[model samples]
Target: MSNNKRVRLSISQKIDLLDQNATGQLNQTDLGEWAMKKFNLDQPLAQQTISNILKNAETLYSNVNVVKNSKSLKTTRYPQLDDEVEKFVADMNNSNLPVNRDSILRYVRHIAQVKCRIPGKEISFSSGWLTKLFKRIGVRSRPMHGESASVDISSENIQNELRKIEELLEPYDPVDIMNFDETGLYYQQPPRRTICSESLGGLKKSKTRLTVGLLCNSDGSYKGHPVVIGQHKSPKCFKTRANLLSMTAIGKKHEVVYHYSTNAWMTNEIFTAYVKKLDVAFGRQNRRIALLLDNASVHKIKIPLNNIKLIFLPANTTSKLQALDAGIIANFKAHFRAQQYDRALCLYISKKLDNLDVYKMDQAQAMFFLANAWLKVNPETIKNCWQHTKILAFKEKTICDFEPVEYPTSALPLEEEIVAELNGMIPDLPGNFNNEVTDVSQLNLEADESDMIVCYTANTTNNEETAEG
Candidate 1:
């Protein structure tokens, strides 16, 4: 277990040793020279016994010892990370904290090159040793629930929407289905804490888990033809019908512009105005358009618009049927993470408050950082999106032989499902599952039921083996 006993050579030493016998077929004397070069030893260290040394090394340390641990058997007077990489690593350690190895590896990999000019900081070699070290330390960083948003969807509505979506699925044309919706765009960083473990430097805010809310599509970065929509991604005067209808992603087709609108945008005026234009744009006659929408108050609040069909989301369950929640949004975030190498598209957001204790500076700087990140997100290359949405089924009351519960009468109706219906539930190609997700069983249930036992069949998955072993 004590790696200190092993001989490990620096990359430079290995390269120098390999240089002598370019063919790597050396006689005993040459082997002695190679060993001397690799270990920086005095000549004649293994002068006549080069073969014995090589054989002994192979027997004791394995064949890879010649290359893998060329810098073996050297312990520094100060046993710390490289000086250049210290800032990147900061106080990460294995104290009372998780003793997390993978977290450490992630921290190391993320900040490796950013550490310094030295390449050793780039990545870890000696997979066996790193594995051993990680096993010894263990991962302290574990992901919990998304703390900010607390939205829920019911199983009953999930089933209904599944039925509706299935019926709608009868007529197939991916290009025909158009999804629309409005989400908030807050310029903020995810909460970070100092990693508080003995082995870790405690949770510190590095550019980690940066989450942003962007209204995009299953296929493209929600392109609102900034060329046409200008600065008003949403209208300044509380979003109007014309504002929603007029908004276009410079190059996108008007008919294909079906997206969702939110009551959060507020007002029957904007909702009505937008619906009218959308009606004229995709009249039932022009091309047979079915509007999918969530049961936001406005769709029902406004005196019903004739000719425009409104698909009401099940009471208290749009999150279940909604396409974006289970589909496009997941895909976008995945793309955002996969490319987080060499500081790709991620920003270092600092929460330095102004004298008034406002996060204005953080928001301003964060938006600026996100603007550049937008360029990196092409939103074209992704897969398996909406896999979560396809098999989605929500039922209010199970018949029998399954989990039972009291449905809340006060629960907000599963109203949001229609946003996709109002816009036409859009399907994405393999590419742009950027936000595509498998149905993440948010199953947010508080213990109102003492009688219910939430158990499942013995699925017999040994996934927890990694943790236990």
Candidate 2:
């Protein structure tokens, strides 16, 4: 049998061929010869492929229907398989797993062999069948990446915890209710893709990063200045440059505060200083202010401060319960990336004319980008994120009610677009960049002490009155 001569036949043609061979009007050899001539095959069909089709002729005929007085062919094989495949896809989606042709084929074989009691050798899950199944099911496979797993959002315990937070917020206004979370940004890391020569298989990207703490109120009424933490206490980049202080001033204008740690980790002491600043800025001396935070070790405060309450979300539930995770952080990242792209474009143009290396991003540039990105995040986005987690419900009592809106889909340009803008400046641009900016905030869940308490005291003097959770 010549593999190259094989021709794909329509369902009606297959059914007619089966009937002709079954009735003995044409023997198998004669039918094969006739099929070769009729289909003008370049090579003969594989015997196994042909035999499988012949053996399943009746099953195919029964499963498919031919339109009356027409040559239209339609298949209705294994209707239940569609439902089973859909459920399998749904399961994969919920677990944040990737689904592809190979995975689907494996699943189908499993169903046939184990669930349907069919022998593994008897199951015929061809690539063609898989393709048709995808079309029938209206699903297209796309590249996907895995995310950190946490507690199930719909679990009873998580729901109850969220409800408790909602009730706890009833006494305070939106401005008094704030959510604080921290995430790491690889400021100087090249995008997952970079323009490089083909000789370089993959560009070595930078690991230079900074941890940023974001604070925003539930009502979207106020967004506190971002607290940026870097590795060095006073980086030479800022200390040596005469104009670097001016760049820091740009961040300050956008309400971006700077801090530093030995390892760039948000420590309890740093968090305390941040909270004290928050108290002073928000004027929490007399009013009760609620600060919602995820269960992170760095967020733990040994002693409580005045008039500020620290509420920790349920363990392993930040992905679902944290307002920052809902969408605010994502928007902030998008804006930051957009700024990076703009900088790259400017460099590309400059490098073309002046022959200067424009790929390296400095700390000052990174801070400027970060500050502007935070400012770009609109109040609507903050409010929507809080509402999304059901932590704060928007009231419709007033004529102008806060309507939850998503971050605009077109707010950030596609990576492809950015690359195109820099076309010809760099050779062999990567098809895709590693761009997996790890949301370190979600991945690092280890607590320094399990019994650590975060207390909100009435004032700096009244440290004795701490609310223990």
lDDT of 2 at 163: 73
The residue-by-residue lDDT of candidate 2 on 332-410, one tens digit each, is 9999988887777787876753323344577767777888898899999988888887656533332256576787654
- How much does each candidate deviate from the true structure in C-alpha RMSD? 25.1, 27.9
Best model number under lDDT: 2
lDDT of 2: 0.71
Q: Using TM-score as the measure, which candidate wins?
A: 2
lDDT of each: 0.40, 0.71
Q: Model 1: what TM-score?
A: 0.35
TM-score (all chains, Cα) for each model: 0.35, 0.59
Off by over 4 Å in 1: 1-140, 145-157, 188-269, 283-292, 299-309, 312-321, 326-384, 391-469
Tens digits of per-residue lDDT for model 1, 70-172: 3443332222333322333234332212334455456555454454333763344345645544332332235532211233443565666657764664353
